[model samples]
Target: MRWSALLNPGFLVAFVVLTVSAIGMSAAIRAYGLHLQKLEIHAPGNRQLSALPRETPSWKQIGTDQIMDEDTVKTLGTENYVSRVYIQKNPPAGQEPIALEFHAAYYTGGIDTVPHVPERCMVGGGWLQTKGAQTLALEDVDTSTWIVDAAASGGARGEVYSVRTLPAPYSDAPGTRVRLPFGVAPDKPIHMRISAFGDPKTGKTLYSGYFFIANGGTAASAEQVRTLAFNLTSDYAYYLKVQFSSAGVSSAQELAELSSSLLGELIAEIMRCVPDWTLVESGEYPPDNPRRRTGASN
Candidate 1:
């Protein structure tokens, strides 16, 4: 008696409504999945590695000539659409290791990993601040005042300042921050000495300096610089220091090249010691003097 009654017009209407609702929900879910896929891997594009001219310093006199058999470095992208940079140092050195800090961009897909944030990774009070995509400003947390020599010779003599601007980590944040961890806590202020000198005429040296920046009181500093110097060697590494006032490392495209001199000396030493070791993407290296285990990563 109920079979025919169950097949009423009302039942058909309810069935059609439920079916449509299910189809709509499925479509919405598929659309969201596609959106997330888009964020997972950014489109492959021109991810320039070194913005400035590069010099391949010789490590012949250094012991690296004997210990290192294969010396090569390649970077790639990893993590939430970010590049994870790594160096595979093989053959190995005994006590003295060779290291070099090869400059790179974070989002470049060619590398397996890159620094979490090249501009924000503070080492010795260095971080990058940005007003927008074009204005990549350097903020100094180091106590040392560094001078800037804008004019650099070589192919980079005319290169202008370029930056990859990023937004704040959180939507509600006040401003964006770039971090390159040098393990200097907010409690202690990092100290450094800085000076710049470059002769575009001879093209021997573009710039040079030593400086320091320490944390004021927090685990981090409010003022940071958009700069970093990575030690090429695995041991006793010192990063090139810069100040917030040291804006426009160059009026031309000489940021990487001009700063290369400062970094070149430091990196050359590392490579001399550890020929097999490649540059790390973490952008973190041990202080020339070894730190305690717990404090190493700091």
Candidate 2:
């Protein structure tokens, strides 16, 4: 018998609600199925299919040359979704800061565009200054967001590494390491000291430890990627260092706003570090920084 028939018009309404409740329960169970199964030492293999598309690429490779160099330091913010807070210093020509729209992987648009290149963490607004001058306030925006790279570490036998190698504008350079100076070891949890500066218009600075799994190109195992994300989430906290031009001038509202904004950005950045778990084209896509184009035209 059809389950909806048990109740007349009135009963039918109740039956619909019951059916919805059942569906919700089922969804909840499925979401945490892995967690539950592990506790009971039962392997829930093939119990449910993964939501990710099987056809998704293995890794996203940017030619390490597509990122704009002039906008070297960008704070990607994610409050409701991904946002960009780019800081520029004398951008050449094509390197002028531009804000492209952010689209999430789960979001549906006319066309299925891959999610924006998510950053590991938001390194709050940076200090823009000349060699001999103090940092100045150029541009500031609302708190922004960045994506966490959770899948880089192909689980199990794979390794995850975070680096801060540098030469200034490192994001746009191919095969360049600015500083391996700061990063967590493979399988270690991610942590960082986040700092910020604010004023009437000047925004804050947000920084965090780098955390990415090394999914050995085409040769990585699934376990390797999973382990990388697992280790990263273990240590998650925002150490925000507040930078202010003049102390006590700004009221609590201003300071609170800045603080809250910084925190939100931090969370979004961490999310980016999480592996997309989807395959993507691999290659170094460098940013088109005009400064790079001007050959010796400082």
Candidate 3:
């Protein structure tokens, strides 16, 4: 009776279906798993991902970019990042000098995991998520003349490294470090993500703006980044987050829109430190490629 039941046509058909389903599932897992693919960590010639430009014709960097301890770095999951404030020089009367708080972080390789965006961190840190994250479509930034990188100079291992290695009036051909530097051009439109937080204690509102560049595309939120960073098609993956913080701004979107010119210029310096996605998509610039191209990252 047991053998006859096992050999029944319905039972045999069900067993075959289960067997085929399992085999197909295994094949799909093998093909699409992120762990099965190669991982890459990219940086500028200076080897410090935080070595961005310090000065431009309009603004100058001031204040220390927090000196992170071991625990902080570990919590961040990657040492390659920047968090600095650039104070605008000599503002017009009745207007406060603009303080552009800038930040960038890159994650790849074994450090691969969920990205940490400010919306979550700030709210958890005692700020209210006054407004949900919003996407601000910005005018295109031209880079035909900018992004000409000289060989990387400094090799600082931590956050103590200054944004600039030389004196003012930034030289395109300085004998010193030239990590990331660029000017504004309106051609390549980019998207920015922004969220606002209110500090109950101070009764003040602060805004955090950012965008994610993963693989060869860009996203406005952590949820979107997850999809872009782990898509089945890409063999290598990384997420470069460029963020800005501002206080006294009415809204995060306004802050981003009002500061578009400044942010556009700042992005030029920031992109130099980011990996050129064109080559990454082409499998030309792997982590070990050694040939650095500060190519288009819009």
Candidate 4:
């Protein structure tokens, strides 16, 4: 604490050198961190909206994936999206066919977001809200397949093969199933919002259900989108906008129960559309695996 000690030339020079060195080290570390980001670059694949799977186990894609209008795409803020529908190829017993629609968008590295939901769009377009926002339970639908993409093995460019990997749904005894609605997986729960509206014009129940799987988890509601998409701990983020509708679905539970098959097969394909979080966290950016899904080993 002495004034003479503070004025000591040797101590003063050492203190100054240490302070400057710390500041320079900090800047260099920041630059190196930025450089590390550049190293984690993913080579693009068939992630384009058009590349969405055309068929699943029980459903056939109605047609090609639709392209959104320019204004709608601009409003959503990203073009990495797919707007498509699939029709049940073989409805059970006497049940009518089910048609499910899907729209998914992926965005990364930004905090800015815009609010867009089915309710808002429907009401503005003269639709009435028949049912309030509800958490529809998505039961487990076990669907798996083997994907042999020629691109992955550096063989022919367009030779992709498929093989059945796992047993079909309902293969297990009724005693083994969960009592509650399990979204994507048993260990990994996901959020799905199903809202019913009165299509007073068509007199048919308008069912729209959606959920989000971003980074490494899922969000059921819109409020979680911003937080999940732009967290401080990670540099990559993505969200899914899944909407399914059917005139024959009389109730929310029925819609959810029946959707198990279609969504079961479709969810894995959706994962391919987003960046792989496992690799992102480890700072490794390899080409995407077309066959990868939540529980698949290969």
Name the best candidate (by lDDT). 3
**RMSD (Å) of each candidate, 1 decimal:** 22.0, 21.7, 8.6, 11.1
Alpha-carbon error at 129 in model 1, in Å? 5.1
By TM-score, the best candidate is: 3
Query: Which is superior by lDDT, 2 or 4?
Result: 4
TM-score of each: 0.20, 0.18, 0.70, 0.66
Per-residue alpha-carbon lDDT of model 2 for 1-298, expressed as tens digits? 8875765698878879999999998788655422221101000121111111111111111122123333332222212222222122233477532211112211111121122221212212334221121222211212221222344444442443333211222222222311111122322322211223332245432221111222111101223324422222111111111121113223323333332323222222322333212221121111222223432111
- Where model 4 places Cα greater than 4 Å from the true spot, the runs are 1-46, 143-184, 187-189, 286-298
Error of 2 at 167 (Å): 15
Model 3 TM-score, 2 decimals: 0.70
- How much is 86 displaced in model 1, in angstroms? 16
Poorly placed runs, candidate 3 (over 4 Å): 1-38, 44-46, 110-112, 140-188, 287-298
lDDT of 4 by residue, 1-76 (tens): 6889978999999999999999998798665432222222221463654555576557778877887799988987
How well is each residue in 251-287 modelled by candidate 3, as lDDT tens digits?
A: 7665766456565455545555666554554345665
TM value for model 4? 0.66
Q: Can you rank all candidates by lDDT, best first?
A: 3, 4, 1, 2
> Between the candidate structures 2 and 3, which one is better when assessed by TM-score?
3
Q: How many clashes would you count in candidate 2?
A: 65
Model 2: which ten-residue window has the lowest total lDDT? 37-46
